[model samples]
Every structure is written in C-alpha cells, then in structure tokens.
Target chain A: MIKLQNIEKVYRTDTIETLALNGINLHVAKGEFLSIMGPSGCGKSTLLNIMGLLDEPSKGELHIDGHTVTRLSDKELAGFRNKRLGFIFQSYHLINDLNVLDNVELPLLYRKVNAKERRRLAAAALEKVGLSNRLQHFPSQLSGGQKQRVAIARAIVGEPEIILADEPTGNLDSAMGNEVMDILIQLNQHDKTTIVMVTHDEQMARKTHRLVRLFDGSQVQ
Target chain B: MLKNYFKIAIAVLKRRKFFTFISLFGISFTLATLLVLTAFLDRIVNHEYPDAKRKQSLYISGIEERGERARSNSGLSISYIKRYVLPMKLPGAIAFSSRSNGTNTYFHGKKIGIDYKFVNSVFWDILEFDFLEGKPFTVQQEKNLEKVAVISQDLRDNYFGKDVPAVGQYLEANNEKYRVTGVVRNVPASTYMLSSDMYIPYTLTKDDMNTPSYFGEYAAILLAKKTSDIPAIKKEYEDIVRRVPHTQKRFLKTTSLADSYLDAYIRGGSQESKQKVWVYTALGIFISLIVFLPIVNLVNINVTRIMERSSEIGVRKAFGATRKALVYQFIVENIILTLIGGLVGLVLAQLVMIILNNADLIKNLHLSLNFTVLFIGLLTCLVFGFLSGVYPAWRMSRFPIVKALKA
Candidate 1:
C-alpha cells in the first residue's frame, strides 16, 4: 500500500516558480491496480515520478507500507526503491548496450544477487513476458513490442511491492498495446501485483481496479 | 559485479573509438615522458656499474674562495688534493682525475673524436671498470709518467681492428703516440663520470702539486675505508683548508663535496650547499606538469563520457543502484582505461630510452626498465585515472533518476 498527503511539487528556476502538483492526497491499497489518466502536461508523469521516489515532492508526507519514505536519504531511498518499486518508461528505457537478459537482470543486480540466480530469475521473468527466445538480443535488435515486453520482464523480475509505469504502451501499436494491457491484467489478477500506471486511454483506465483523473496538477475525480 | 562493470567498460570503450583514442592518447603520452625523465633521474642519483660505491665515495668537484666582498671558485688542483685530500689516513683509496678532454684521432682515414680522462693508478681501485685486455696502468707507470694508455673496446676496434690486440699496439692522439696498456668495454654515454674513450696517467699530462693558489683543473674522488670515516675526513680536510696561508690573503677558502645533484649543478652562496624548499617545489611542479596535462585532458574526456552515459546511469539508479555504486563503476572503468594506457606508455618509454641510448644523447647513458620506474609509471596511470574519473562520476551520480532518464 502507498499513501500521499497534501503533496505539492513546485519547479523552480532563476525567475520562474511553476506549480506542477498541488494539494494532491491519494492512497492505493495493497494488490490494487490503479490508472491515472490526464491530458499532456497535466502532471501525470510528475505525480508518478514523485510516487516512485525518483523525484521528491516539494512538500508532502509519503508513506509506503506504513513507513515514511520522503525523509529518507538519497542512499536509503535507492535501497527502498530497489526493494519496493519498479518503473516502466514509455521508451522502455532498456540499456541499449546490454542484451535482453542483462537488461532484465538489472534490478536483481542492485540487490547483490548471485549471477547464476539472477540469470535464472531474469530468464523466468522473460519467459512470463514471452521473450524467452530473445535472451541474447540487444534492445537495438528488438521490435517496439518486444522491447516493451523486455521492459515488463525487467519490472516484474524483482517482485517489487509496487510497479510505477509511465505510458507503458504509449509507443506500441494497438494490438501490441492490448497485449501489454493483457499482461498487466494477468499480473494484477494472478500475481496480485499492484500497478500504478499513467495512461490516456479510457479503455485501459476502465480495466483497472480504480481510476483517478488529474487536470492542472490536481485530481479532479 | 565488478567484473560486469569491467566488461561493460571495455565494451563501451570499444563502442566509441574516438573517445577511447582521445583518452589513450593523453594517458600514454603523459606517462611515457614522465617515465623517461624518471629513468634518467634514477641513473644519475643511483649508480649501477662503475660507481657502485657512490654512497661510500666523496667527490671534490670544485672549491670556493671567499674573502669579504670578493669570491672565486674553480675545480680542484693537484696541490689541493695532495696537501688537503690524499693525506687523509681514513680514505680507502684517494684518486685524482682530470676533467674529460676532447681530442681527435684518425682511424682508417676517418677523423674520430675521443673523450680523454687523465687519472692516477688509484682511480682503478675506487670505481669498478671491467677490463677486457691487459690491465690498468700501475702506480709505478704513473710515477714514471708512462706513455702507456687504456682504450675502450670501441676505440680499439676502430684503430687496431676488433680482432687485433690493442694492449700491445700504439695509437697516435693529440700529436702524441702512446702504447695501449688496457682495453675496456665500451661504456654507455649515459655513464657521464667514467665514460671516456681513452685513459692516461695524470703525470703524463704534466701534473705535480706545484701550484700555489690551490686551484686548477682536477677532481678528487675519495673512497672511505668505512662510511663512518667520512666525518673525520671532512673535518680534517676543512682543518687543512683553515691552516693554508692563502697565496692571496684577501681570498677566503672553502671546499666540500656537493651532497646532491642539485647542489652540484647549482653553485652559489651557502644556500646552494643545503636543500632549498624551492628545489623540492620546482621538482614537484615538474612532476605535476608531467602528470597534470594528461589528467586534465582525461577529466574533460570523462566529463563527456559521463554525459553520454547519463541515461545508463539513471537506469541503473532507478533499478536500485546507489550513488556509491555508480561512482565505483565509473572509477573502475577509468582505472581499466588508464591501466591499458599505462602498458602502452611503458612500451613507449622503453622505445624512447632505446632511441636515447642509440642516439648517444648522453654519454655512456644506457637506460632500461627497472622495477622502480615501472612502479612509478603504473601508479601515475592509476592516480591519473582515479583523479580524472572521480569528479565526473560524482557529478553524474548526483543526477536525479527522473531527470537523467528523461534526458
């Protein structure tokens, strides 16, 4: 479970102070799949980043699994994020230099897991994502859909408490998008994995356990 | 984990050939030059063959004459060595030698330049010289001012042919004919002190301690019976100097062996006789210059590399890699880079030394890769790598994962 209270995110420059998020209070229960839908520049990605601990809200109380995470040091936050959170970017964000197996093993590597075991878990995760045959293929060699599949495998390999995906299927074709959506649904249904995804598709939003819409950095409904 | 990072580092370097080339250029060029200079310095400060007893030997290269506002200095004379130096009972062997002279001889219708050194028989006892044919001129030969001379293998080969015996033959030099008494191995030009092509007795050069002012063209090398005997020798020499009624009352006299090379090269007031901070400062700045240029260039290269790899760093951080991990990865990559460069630099340094020896840039100067030089070279590369990598690594590691990933 994750909680955010009176969250405020402000972007500051030499002569500008822009409000990216304001007075946003939300909570997602354990094993719940949630979708955040909004137009472009509606702070959807910013909110997701804040929740993922990749960026800190200017002012807020953040609690993950009943533990305060906002006050944690950078080092502590990294450990916490590694153990509790996974992120899937619209770009798939795979390290292009590494092969699919290596990209999938990234999360487990930070945990100091043994190489042999990491390889096993990564292979298994890739198998679940239907990418078992593309183990040695680099990201450059993969199709858009296959790259997304590899990203999903990387996300679930660590078995984190929460998955934060920003536009997980934004760059894929309709059929590939649906396939990815189906995989997310299967994870939510069979694995009972909580996923907080930000998307613009109403059909995708309807498939989640709950949906929240944001406009101008505030949750309207 | 480290192995993985190393693999990635090597791969990444291989991926971007231009960046790798730029980094290697700076690292190798910098280390090569520094190692060459270091090797030369080592040769000068630490003797290997002839002057093996450099630590136990004291040299009187020159003397200073001072009187209130008037002062003058010159190389030692026979009078000074006999009255003030050879009389010392503590010396294992006291030898006097002339400063190397240049002369011309005809070998097979070609004019050959030869460096000539005039010395007493005791010179043979002080420094170790390998003899190939016959033996050194004896004290009796020196006393008799014998025309017999010692010639190097190079000179023997040029004049009498390599197969013929040089010891029994006569060679004409400086319009004087002398029978060869000994043939020695051709010494490298780097060995500056005893690197002459020909050797003759100082008595043959018309030398007696008849000079009155205690100054002439000679250097005395005093080998101590025991290292502890040096203090007494120095004290006794200074006492003899004090007692000498100056040929010129206005000329105050002082003489001591310059302790270090800096002292020998830099001649001045009493300050020159002791170690100065600027000497170390100059040395430090010289060494830093050799190392800093490459490191500075490397820092810029590393900065560019960090920028290019920022996304990869973010992905790693997002996956739970700590700032420490990111920093360590970059540093290791740099270390690997520099070590490769270090090996190349080492090879380059050997090549430079070979050229220097072949070119005869310094007389009898033969340099090889010793353990000390290799250690210094490797350390330079490592430190250069670490220094250049840490800053860029730290800067990139501080990037917010979200911002970096988006970039």
Candidate 2:
C-alpha cells in the first residue's frame, strides 16, 4: 500500500520554474492491479517515480506500508526500495554487459544473496516468464518482447510487495504487448502482487481493475 | 566481496584495451622515473656504507697561516706526524702517510710499469684491503728500512704470470729492486683512495721533518676510535700541532675523510663543494616532479571517467551500495592499477640497470630490490590512489537516484 498527501515536485533553473507534480493526492491499496493513464507530459512518470521512492517531493507526506518515508535518508530509501519495491521500465534498462541471468539477478545482488542461491532464484523467476533457456543470452541478442519479459522477471525476482512499471509495453508490438499484459494479469490474479503500470494505451488501461488519469500534473478520477 | 570487485575491475580493464593501455602507460612511466632515480640514489649512498662502521675514520690536515691568508692541506710533515699522530692514545686510532705522484711503472723481468703509491706501515690497518698472498710489511721493516713492497693482483698476473706468488720476489720500481712482501686485490674504484698496483713503505730515513719546504705535502689518513670521536681527535691534533715551538703561530686544521674524498675531485675550490648537495637535491626534485605529472593527469582522467558513469553509480546506490562501499571500490580499483604499474616499472628499472651495468656507466652499479624500496613503492601507490580517487568517488556516490535515472 502507498499514500501521497498533497505532494508537490518542482524543477527550477536560473530563470524558469516547472511543476512536475502539483498538489497530488493518491492511494493504492494492497493487491490492486492499477493503471495510471495520462497523455504525454501529464506528470504520470514523475508521480510514479515519487511513489517508487526514487525522487523527493518538495512538500508532501509519503507513507509506504505504514511508514512515512518522505523524511528517510537516501541510504534508508535505497534499502527500502531494494526490499519492498521493484521497477520495470519501458526501455527494460537491462545492462548491456550482463547476460539475461545476471540482469534478472541484479536486484537480489543488492540484497547480498550468495551466488548459488541468487542463480537458483533468478533461474526460477526466468522459468516463470518462459525464459529459462535464454539465460546466457545478452540483451542485444534478445527480442524486444524477450527483453521486456526479462525486465518483468527481474522485477518479480526479489519477491517485492509492489511492482512499478512505467510504459512497460511502450517498446513492444501489439502481440508482445498483449503477452506482457497477460503476464502482469496472471501475477496480479494468482500471486496477488500489487502492480501499478503507467500506460498511454486506452485499450491497455481498460484491462486493469482500476485506472487513474492525470492531466497537467494533477490526478483526476 | 573484494574478490568480486577485483574480478569486475580486471574484466573491465581487459575489455577496454585503449583505456587500460593509457592508464598503464601513464602509471608505469611515473613509477619508472621514480624507481630509477631512487635506484641511482641508492647506488650512491648505499653501495659500501650501508653496513660499514668506517664512519669513524678521520682525515688529519694541517692549516698553516702564511701572512693574512691561511692555506689548509690534508698532508702532514714527518715532524707533525711524529709529534701528533703517533703519540695519540685514541682507541682504534691508526695513522698512515701516503704520497701519490704520476702513475708509476713496475717491471718484473721486462714488462712495463704500473701505477703505485708510496705508503707507510699503517696503510694496512687503516684501509680495507684483502691480501692475496703473504702479510703486510711489519712495523720494524717500515721504521728501520725500505726494501719491502706490496703488489696488486694485476701486476702479479702481468709480470709473473697468474697463480704465481709474487711475494718474496724482487720487483723494480723507481730504478730500485724492492722485494714483494704482499700481494693485495685491486681496490674498487668507488673507494676514497683507489687501489694501486704497488705500495712502498715511507721509511722516514732521511730526517725530512726539518725541511719546511715539504712540511704539508704528503697525504695522511687517520682512523679514529669512533665516528663520534673524530671532532675531538681532530681538535686534539690541531692543538698539538699549534703548540709546537716553530708552528705555534700557525693555524693547523684537520678534515673529515668525506671532505678529503670530495676535495680529491674538486681542487682549488671551496664554492664547488656546495654543488654536490645541489646536484643531489636537483636530482630528487626532478624525479619527484616527473612522477607527479602523470599522477595528476591520471587523477583528472579518472575523475572525468567516473563522472561519465554517474548513472551506473546511481544504479549501484539504488541497489544499496553505501557511500563507503562506492569509495572503497574506486580506491581499490586505483590501487590495483598502481600495483600493476609498479611491477612493470620495477621490471623496467631492472632493464635500465642491466643496460647501464653493461655499459659500465657506474662501476658496480646494481639494481637492488630491497624491502625498503618495495615498501616505499607500495606506500606511494597507496597514497596516490587514495588521493586521486577521493573526490571522484565522493561525487559519484552523491548522485540522486531519480535525477540519474532520468538522465
């Protein structure tokens, strides 16, 4: 579960000020499959980043799993993110140097899991995503859909309570996007993993249990 | 954890060949300059003095005041030697008078002459000369007569053939037949007094003390009881000489062996004496500056590279890498580079020394890998690595996960 009360995020230059998020209030309950639908530059990504504890709010109270994390130090925030949340990006962001297995095991490495256990867990996660045979292949060797699947596998490998995906299907074709959506739906239904995905596709947003729209840095019903 | 970091570092270095070459070359050049200069200094200061207790040796010279200007000479007259040097009760004190003219020639049956020195009996006790055959001339032989001599191994081999005992055989020197009392190994050129092919005793037969013309012409080597006693011994010798009836008004002085050794090279010059220290200082400064340039360049390059990896740093930070961990990783990486460079530099230093040794640039010049040099090299590498890595590591570790990710 996550809560944001009157959150404000501002970007400033020498002579200009931009509001990435303005007076936003939102809540996500446990085990919910939620979709954040917004047009370009609607601050959907910024809000998602703030909710993921990757960015700081200029003014707000942010509570994650009943702990107010807005005042936590950077080190504390990183620990919380590693232990409690997973992120899947639109570009996948798989390290080019590492193979699929290592990319999937990245999150758990920060958790100080030994190599054998980490490999075992990462292999199991990849198997769940039907990528067990491609463990040694690099991201450049994988297809767009396979890369996205690997990213999803990385996200779920750590067994975090919440998964944040920003445009997870933005780089894939329709069939590949449908496959990725099916995986998310299955995770939400069978594993009860709370996933908050940001997407611009209306058809894709219609499949989630709930949807929140954003316009001009503000959330709308 | 450290092993994994090392594996990653080595892999990265191997993968990026150009960067690795640049870093390695820079570090190796810096380290090579340092090592070569340090080796040179070691050769100078540590060749024969590292374990030598000969610091106790002192040189006795007489300063005579002639009018307004005073002239100091390291040679003492026979009278001065008899009065001051022989009566001294200093515990390990031995005095020897020597005079060197042109390089003399010696003939066995008819082979040409060799360089030689006419010295006294105390020469054997004062200098470290290994005898190849027979014993040194006795005190009685030196004090009573002048028939005995000492020859070098070179003279023996050239005149009497190798492996033959030149001792007890007559050698012609200065148109006189002198019987060889001993054969000594050639003195190393690095010594204060170079080795000679022959040594003849100063018999003091003709009562030359009364002759003021040759008062301060001969060279004297005074071996003191201890290095600490040199000043007192020199003062005593000076006081004793000045108290003599005829030489009372004259100022007599004594010099240390080091000063005499230096004066041997630079005669008629007191100003040039300071140039020795200046030369050593300049050498030290030049080597230090040369080493510093590459270190500075490396630091700048590393900082820029680390800046380019800000996003990777952010990812590591988000994965729970502490600021300490990040700093440690970078510092370790630098140390690894420097250590490898130092080893390469050591090899380079040996190659240089080998070439110089073959060329005979420095007689007996050797490359010694002592613990001190190794310690100094490692410590220098550690300091350089830590100093160069600190600011970049700090900057990299402070990246905001959000801003870095967005970028």
Candidate 3:
C-alpha cells in the first residue's frame, strides 16, 4: 500500500522556478495495478519517481508499505529501496557491460547475497520473464523487446513489494507493448504484486485496474 | 559485488582501448622512472663493499681555515689527522686517504685510464672489501713503503686478461710498477671516495704527506667499535678540533666537520643540527614532489574517465549501492589498473637497468632491482593507486542519481 498527502516538488534556477509537482494527493491499495496518464510535462514520471524514492519531494509526506519513507536518511533510503521497491525505466536501463543474468543480479548484490544464490535467483527471474535463453546475452545483444523483458526480470529479481515502471513499453511496437502488458497483468493477478506504471498510452491505461490523470503538476482524476 | 565491479572495469577498459593505453603508458613510464631512480639512490646511499660499515663510520672530509684576507676549505692533511684525530680515546680505527688521481696506463697497445688512491694500511681495517685473490698489504708493508697495491676486479680484468690471475702480477701506472697484492670486488662509482681502480700506500707517494699545513688532498675515515659509539667519537673529535692550536698564522682559526657520508654529501661546510633539519626537509620535499606530481596528473585523467561512467554509477545507486560502495568499487578498479601498469613498469625498469649497466654510463655502477628497490616500487604503485583513485572516486560517488542518470 502507498499513501501521499500534499506532495510538492519544485525545480529552481537563478532566474527561473518550475513546479514539477504541486500538492499531489494519491494512494493505491495492496495488489493494485495502477497506471498514471498525463500529457508532456505533466509530472507523471516525477510522481512515479517520488513514489519509488528515487527523488525526494520538496514539501509533503509519503508513506510506502506502512513506513514513513520521507524521513529516512540517504543510506537508510537506499536500503529501503533495495528491499522494498524495484524500477523499470523506459530506456531499459540495464548496464550494457553486464550480461542479462548479471544485470538481474544487481539489486541482490546490495543484500550481500552469496554469488551462487544470486545467480540461481537471477536465472529464475529471467525464466519468469521468458528470458532464460538470454541469460548470457549482453544488453547490446538483445532486441528491444528482449531488453525490456530483461529489465522486467531485473526489476522483479529482488522480489520487491512494489514495482514502479516509467513508460516500460514506450519504445516498443504494439505487439511487444501488449506482451509486456500481459506479463504485468499476470504478475498482478497471480503473484499479487503491486505495480504503478506511468504512460501516455490510453490503451495501456484501460488495461490497468485504476487510472489517474495529471495535468500541470496536479492530479486531475 | 567486487567480482561484478571487476567485470565492468575490464569491460569498460576493453571498450575504451585508447584511454586505457594512454593511462597505462603514463603510469608505467612514471613508475619505471621512479624505480630506476630508487635503484640509483639506493646504490649511492646504501652500497656495499668498501663502505659496508657505513652506519658505524664517519668521515672528516674537509677542513676550513679562516683568515682576515683569505679563507680556505679543503681536505685534511695527514699531519693534521695524526695530531688531532689519531689520539682520540674513542674505541675506533682511524684511516686516512688521499683524493684519487687519474692516470693513463697502456696494455697491448691500448690506453686504459685508472684512478688511484694513496691510503694507510689501517684503511683495510676500517672498511670491509670482498677480495677475490691474495690479501691486503700489511701495516709493515705500508711502513716500509713497499711497491704493492690492491686492485678492483674491473681494473684487474682490464689490465690483465679476463681469466688471467691478477695477484702477484705487476701493474704499471704513471710509469711506476707495483705488484698487485689483492683483487677486490668493484665498488660502484656512486661511492666516490672508495671507488678507485687501485689503492696504494701513502708512504710510497713522492710528495711529503706529513706537512704541518691544515689543508691537503687527504680525508680520514673513523670507524667506531660499535654503531652506538659514533656519537662519542664525534664528541671526542669536536674536543680535539677546538684545541687545534691555530696551525697557520695567516689562517688564524681552523674549523672542520666530521659527518656520516649522507650528511657530508648534503651539508658540506659545518655539522650544525640546524643544517640537518634543512637537509631532511629538502630531501622530504624533493621526494614528495617526485611522488606527488605524477599522482596529480593521474587524478586529472581519472576524473575525466570516471565522469564518463556517471550513468553506470547512477544505475548502481538506484539499485542499492551506497556511496561508500560505489567509491570502494571505483578505487578497486583503479588499483587493478595501476597494478597492471606496475607489472609493466617492473619489466621496463629491469630492461633499463640492463642497458645502463652494460653501457658503462657511469663506470662500475651496476643498477639492479634489489629487494629494497622492489619493495619501494610496490609501495609506490599502491600509493599511486590509492592517491590517484580517491578523489575521482569520491567525486563520482557524490553525483546525484538524477543528474548522473541524465548524464
């Protein structure tokens, strides 16, 4: 579960100020598959980033999985993120130098997991994403759809409580996009995993359990 | 985790071949130069043969006479050593030697230049030399002004055939023939005072050595019975010097200094404690610059190189890597890089040493990577790795995740 009360984010420069998020209040229950829709510059990714604890909100309170994450120190926040949440980026931000298995093993590394166990779990997660055959393939060697699938396996490798996906299918064709959406649905329905996705695709939003729209840094629906 | 870091580091290096080559070249060249320098300095300051008891010996290298119109600073005369230094109650041996003179000798129609020194028989008792044949001339031989000499291995090889026996053979120099009594190991040229090609008794020289004058081309070596007694010997020498009795009327007062070979090389005029401070400080600064300049350049290069990995850092941080972890990973990567460079440098330094020793750049100087030099080279590599790696690692670790991701 997640909760937010009057979260605000501001970007500042010497001569200009921009409000990225303004008094945003939103929440999602356990096991919910939620999609956020917004136009360009509407703070959808900013909100997802705040929720993932990748960025701090300027002024507000945020509670994730019954913990007040806004007050955690940087080190504590890193630990929290490693143990509780995972992220999938639009660009499939897998380290190009690491093979698919090693990329999936990244989050588990911070947990001090033994290398053997990490490899086993990483392989299993890759299998779940239908990428067992690509374990040794590098990110550069993978196709776009395969790369996105590898990113999904990496995101779920740690078995995090929440998954934040920022435009996971933004760069894929319709068939690949639907395949990714189908995997997310299976994870939500079968594994009871909670996911928050940010997208501009109405069709993708229609597949989710709930939709929230953002306009000019505010939650509009 | 470290394995992963190594994997990425190797991948990145292989991906950026030009940068890796440039970095490796700089590190290897700097380290090789440093290793060569270390070998040369080690030979000069801690050489064996002739000065093996260097720690337990002191040298009265020069005497200073101050007159109203004229001042002179020169080596001690033989008579001055007899009256002022030999009577010292300190438990030690006193030996004096004339400055080496260069002479040309002919053998088989080829000209060979030899440096010769006139030393007292006690010189053998004061310093240790590795003799390959025969023995040092006795005190009686020296007192009798016998025409005998000890020759270096190199000189023997040059004067006689390489495989020929040199002992009991006559070596002619300056039109004077002396039977070689001993063939000792060659002394490195850096040990200038004891590096002569041949040593002969001072009594055999034509010039009067026992002049009452305070200056001559002669220096004395005082070897303490124990290393700890060196201070006592120095104090006794100072007491005798204060009572020097104004030998020359025009040069009314005389002053002199006896010091360790290192101190003698650094501070020549007087043995003041203040001068010792200046000597060590200057040496410290010189060494620091030699070490620090290369590190600064490496740090500059590393900063730019690490910046290119900002996105990788961002991904790690986002996944769960603490700043400490990232910094540690980067430093390890750097250490690995420099250690490879260090191996290359070690080989390069050995090659350079072989070329230098064979070329006869400075006669009799053999630069080899002894244990001490090798240990120092390793330490320099580690220091270079840590110092150059730290700042760039810290800077990269501090990059905000959002900014690094954008980069």
Candidate 4:
C-alpha cells in the first residue's frame, strides 16, 4: 500500500518558479494495479519517481507500507526502496555492458546476496521472463521487447513489494506491449504484486484495475 | 565483489581506449620519473663501495682561513694536517688525498681518458677495496717513493685483454708510466671520494711535507677503530682545530662532511644562518614539484572518469548501494589502475638506467632499483592512487540519485 498527501513539486531557476505537482493527493491499496495517464509535462513521471523514493517532494508526506518514507535519510530510503519497491523506466535502462543475467543479478548484488544465490535467483527471474536462454546475451544484443522483459526480470529479482513502472512499453510494438501488459497483470493477480504504472496509451490505462489521470499537475478525471 | 569491480573496471577501460591511454600515460610516466629519481638518490646516499665503512670515517673536506679583511677557503694543506689533524689519538687510521680528476693516456694509438686519484699509503689501510689480480702496494713501497699503482678492473679491461693480468704491467698515467701492483673491482659510481679508476701513492708523487701552508689542495679522512668512536674523533679534531694557533690572524675552522656539503649551497658565509633549513626547504620543493603535477593531472582525469561512470553509479545507487560502497568501488578501481601503471613504470625505470649507463649519460652511474627506492616508488604509487582517487570518489558519491541517473 502507498499514500501521498498534499504532495507538491516545484522546478526553480534564477528568476522563475514552476509548480510541477500542486496539492496532489493519492493512495493505493495492496494488490492493486493502478495506471496513471497524463499528457506531456503533467508531472506523472515526477510523481512515480517520488513514489519510487528516487526524487524528493517539495512539500508533502509519503507513506509506504505504514512507514513515513519522506523523513528517511538517503541511506535508509535506499535500503527501504531496495527491499520494498522496484522500478522500470521507459527506456528499460538495462546496463549495456552487462549481460542479461548480470543485469538481473545487479539488484541482488547490492542486497549483499552471496554470488551463488545471486546467480541462481537471477537465472530464475530470467526464466520467469522466458529468457533463460538469453542469460549470456548483452542488452546491446537484445531487441526492444527483450530489453523490457530483462528490465522487468531485474525489477522483480529481489521480490520487491511494489513495482513502479514509468512507461514500461513506450518503445515497444503493440504485440510486445500486449505481452508486457499480460505479464504485469499476471504478477498482480497471481503473485499479488502491487503495480503503479505511468502510461500515455489509453488501452493500457483501461486494462489496469484503476486509472488515475492527471492534467497540469492535478488530478482531473 | 572486488572481482566484480575489477572486471567492470577492465571492461570500462577497454571500452574507452583513448581515455585509458591518457590515464596510463600520465600514471606510468610520473611513476617512472619517481622511480629513476629515487634510485639516483639512493646511489648517491646509501650505496656500498670501496668506502664500505663510510659510516665509520670522519672527513675534513675543506678549510677556511680569515684575516682582518682577507678570506680564503680551501682544502687542508699537508703541513696543516700534520700539525693540526694527524696528532689526534682518537682515530685508528689517518689519510689525506688530492681531489680526483681525469687525465688522457695513450693506448693503441688512441687517447683514452682515465680518472686518477692520489692518496697516502694509509688510504689503503682505511678503506676496503676488493682486489681482483694482486695486492695493494706496501707502506714500504710508498715510503721508498715507488712508482707502483692500483688500477680498476674496468681500466685493466681497456689496457689489457679481459682475461689478461694487468698487474706488473706499465700503464701510462698523466704521461708517466707507473707499474701496476694491483687490479681491483671498478667502484660503482657516486661514492664521490672513493670513486676512481686508478689510485697512486701521494708520497710517491707530491709528498715533500715541507710544502707549508694553512690552505692547500689536500683533504684528510680519519677512520675510527669502531663506528661508535666516530663522534669522539670528530670532537677531538674540532678541539684540536680550535687550538691549532691560526697564523691567518683572522679566523680558522674545520667542518664535517655533512656540514661541508650543506655549506656549499648556503649563500651567506655566516655559519649561524641555519642553512640546513634552506637546504631542507629546497629539497621539499623539489620533491613536491615532482609529485604535484602528476597528482593534479590524475585528479582531473579521475573527475572525468567518475563523470563518465556516473550512470553506472546512479543505477547501482538505485538498486541499493550506499555512498560508501560507491566511493570504495571507485577508489579500488583507481588503486588497481595505478598499481598496474606502477609496475609498467618500474620496468621502464630499469630500462632507463640501462640506457643511461650504456650511453655514458652520467659516467658510471650504475643505478639499480635498491630496496629503499623500490619501497618508496611503490609507496608513491599508493599515495598517488589514493590522492587521485578520493576527490572524484567523494564528489561522485555526493551526486543525487535522480540527477545522477540523468547524467
């Protein structure tokens, strides 16, 4: 479960201040698959980043799993994020230098998992994504669809409680996008994983259990 | 995890070949220069040679005489040593020598230059020389003004065939043919006083003793019975000097070898100026100059490296890595980089010494990477690596995660 109240995000320059998120409030229950839809420059990605604990809110409080996360130090927040939340960016963001297996194993490495277990779990995650055969293939060697699958495998490798996806299939073809949406739906329904996704695609938003649409940094519909 | 770091480091370096080359170029070149310099300094300061007992000897290199307005500084004269220095009962052996110089000798229709030094017969008694062919000339031979000499192995190889004996052969030294009585191992260079190709008895050539003066071209060395007695000998000489009855009507004094070397650099004549401080400061500056540029350049390179690697760091931080983990990783990568560079620099340093010796760049500068030089060279590598690594590591670690991902 996640909660945000009176969240505000402002971008500042030498002589100008622009509110990216204004007086926003939202909450999601456990096992819920929520999609946030917005036009360009609507602060959806910023909200996701704040929920992922990667960015700070200008003025607000965010609670995740009954813990006040906004007051946590960077170190504590990182640990909390590692154990409780996972992220999927629009571009996949899989390290080009690492093979698929190593990329999946990266998150567990920070968790101080032993090498043997890290490899075993990473392989299992890759198997779950139907790419066990591509463990040795680098991100550069993979297709757009395959890269997104690897990112999903990486996000779930540590078994985080909440998966925050920012445009998970923005670059994929419709077939590949449908395949990714199916996997996310299966995770929410079978694995009971809570998912929050930001997307511009109306069909993808309609497929989720709930839709939170934003316009000009505020919830409109 | 360390293996993983090194693996990534190698991959990253391989990925950016030109940047790696730049970093390696600076690191290797700087380390090589440091290696060569420390080796040279070791050769000058701590090498073992003909004067292997260097620690047990006291030297009177130069003497200064002052009168109302007249001032002269020179080596101790023969009569001056006899009246003022030789009477010291603290030393086990006493000897004096004229400064060494190079003289041209005719050999096989070629003018070959040879370095020759004049020393008393007691010089052989005070110093240790490894004889290769025959024994040093006797004190009786010196007393009889024998024209016998001791030659270095290198000189023997030039005059005679490598396998042939040069002892008892007449070698032309300064246009005079002196019979060689011994052939000793050539002294490795930088021993200064004991570094010479040939040694001839001073009494045989210039021992008239009646040559009377307070300041003449003569320097004395006193060998102590035990190394511990050196301080006593120095004190006894200084005590004798104070009462030597200065005929200059101005001032007279003597000094130790360390003081003599220090005074040569001092601008003022006043002995109370604490010239050692200036000497140490100059030394500090020279060392700093040698170290500063490489460190500064490496720091800049490290900054660039960290910037280029920021995305990886950002991703790691997003995963779960703390700032300490990131800093530790970067520093470890840097140390590994410089350590490899240090090894390359060491090999190149040896090559440089070989080239210098072969080209006669420093004339018998038989430099080798001694233990002290090696330790300091590696220590320099460590310090250079750490200094070059810390700033970038800290700076990169401080980057906000959201911004770092954007970078």
Candidate achieving the largest DockQ? 1
Give lDDT tens digits, candidate 1, residues B196-217: 8898988878556677766777
- Which residue pairs clash in candidate 2? B105-B113, B105-B114, B106-B113, B106-B114
2 or 4, greater by DockQ: 4
Q: What is each candidate's DockQ, to 2 decimals?
A: 0.78, 0.38, 0.73, 0.62
**Which of the CAPRI classes, incorrect, acceptable, medium or high, describes model 4?**
medium
TM-score of chain B in each prediction = 0.90, 0.68, 0.93, 0.89
The complex in candidate 4 yields a DockQ of: 0.62
Question: Candidate 2: which stretches are off by over 4 Å?
Answer: B49-51, B54-91, B94-284
**Which candidate comes out best when scored by TM-score?**
3
lDDT of 1 by residue, A1-221 (tens): 89999999999999999999999999999999999999999899999999999999999899999999999998899999898898888999898778899899998888979999999999999999999899999999999999999999999999988999999989998899999999999988898888999998888889999999999999998
The window of 10 residues in a row where model 3 chain B has the poorest summed lDDT is B265-274
Candidate 1 regions with alpha-carbon error over 4 angstroms: B66-71, B207-209, B231-255, B258-271, B274-281
Per residue, candidate 3 scores C-alpha lDDT tens digits across B85-146 of: 78878847888888889999999997899999999999998888889998999999999988
Residue B308 of model 3 has an lDDT of 90
* Model 4: per-residue Cα lDDT over B1-407, one tens digit each: 77777877777778888878888888888888888888887776666566677777766776656655766666667778778778889888888776677898878987777988888889888778889989888889888988989988888888776858988899988768899999998776555657688888877555467665666666777888998897777678777766656665555443323133223224222233344577668878888887898889889988987898777787888888888888888888888888988898898899998888788766667888888988998998888888899999999988987788887
Per-residue lDDT over A33-152 for candidate 4, one digit per residue giving the tens place of the 0 to 100 score: 999999999999989988999889999999999999999887898799788888887888877767898889888877878999999999998888889899999898999999999999
lDDT of candidate 1 at residue A135, scale 0 to 100: 100
Q: Is candidate 3 or candidate 4 better by DockQ?
A: 3
- TM-score ranking from best candidate downward: 3, 1, 4, 2
